[model samples]
Target: MVLRPHGGEKVRLMVVGRKRLPDAERHERHWGFVEAIADSAKDLEKGLRAQSYGTRTRGERTQPAARPAGEGVYAVTLEDGQMHLSFALELPAKPGEVQKAFRIAPEASYALSIKNPEKGKPVNAGLREEDEADYPRRLQEEFRGRRFAREDVRLLDFEGAEFILIGARSNPEAEYGLDLDTHDEDYQHAEVIRRLRMVKSRHPIKPLFEGRWA
Candidate 1:
């Protein structure tokens, strides 16, 4: 991701060693995100809110869509500066289910209490000093820092369509003291909107431009 600050100068992100997700995995993830958003919108159109559960027909059971497993961190602003932390907990367990797990980027937490997040929801991540109480011996031995990123997967209305936007607080710009004036409420949101122009040509959603949320 490239960030153009106040001046016209651009600052490109450089990773030590970037690992690209396999073509198959990337396609699956892209489709998964698209399907999840479309499914929720379909339910909403029928006046049925599909958050925890879904609305089904006579004999068919509408199952909750499966999203990419693991944690997603997001930080967004609202009209009145209210912190809206939205989370969707899904339980996908059956006989023949596709369980593909992908680890992207450097996760914020120093250590995780739950060894496997693909199996269930986000548990007590031993990221805080107080979170030491969660572990039996890990806390007693090593010191865990309080700094950790909170994540969220939100459905953002792009143009007239909705898209799944994964947000995480542990962005490289913030970590490197580059994008530091974090007081602006819509800092992240604006940046995301601006960058959508670059993806308009290839992304399936075809996000044209930013518009008022309808």
Candidate 2:
């Protein structure tokens, strides 16, 4: 199995299994499946970045690579016999909140997940029957109605959080990670496109995407 953590490397371990595990035992089965990582004491310490004190990008070799100091929301999952541990695509509900962005793995594709309706009942969230669901991937209020003096940054959001989204214009494999099934050609406004790139630039976009697709 592969452990895709925020650390600079992918920790791979092999788990021998009978190939058939009971469904009732699935949730509590993770602790039992861990194989011998054979990672040294120093290696384990560095994996968690126990020595990190301040935030540093992956290329900043001067210090350890780790998350920023704050309340970071993450999506941790173990699926298909591979453990996926990474920062999630998200926005802040309040001001002065920092979104956690970790290093981009050149080996992995960073896709966006733009929409999520009420996972709970509608009545619990005080929603009308016809109300459109929240576009979690959509950029609601970026920079909180503010922008830099010179940087013409655009922002958008998405949830095609994997290999499925090509993010291209009119391509069959391409998809926009938005609440509405949008495409690059369908976007009439340049401002919306600009904001999407801004959001992509934060953590793992740079040379890989350059914010061409949000």
Winner by lDDT: 2
Candidate 1 on 1-214: residue-level lDDT in tens?
1112334232222111122211221222110111112222222222211234435655545443222222223223331322222211111111012222222333211111111111222354212332121333432222223222122112121111111122323333433223233322232344423332322222312111221123
What TM-score goes with each of the models?
Answer: 0.19, 0.16
| Candidate 1 segments exceeding 4 Å error | 3-9, 15-102, 105-190, 205-214
Worst 10 residues of 1 by lDDT: 109-118
Q: After superposition, how far is residue 16 of candidate 1 from its true place, in Å?
A: 4.8
Error of 1 at 30 (Å): 25
lDDT by residue for model 2 (112-133), tens: 2211232323354323434432
For model 1, which pairs clash?
72-151, 72-152, 73-151, 73-167, 73-168, 74-152, 74-167
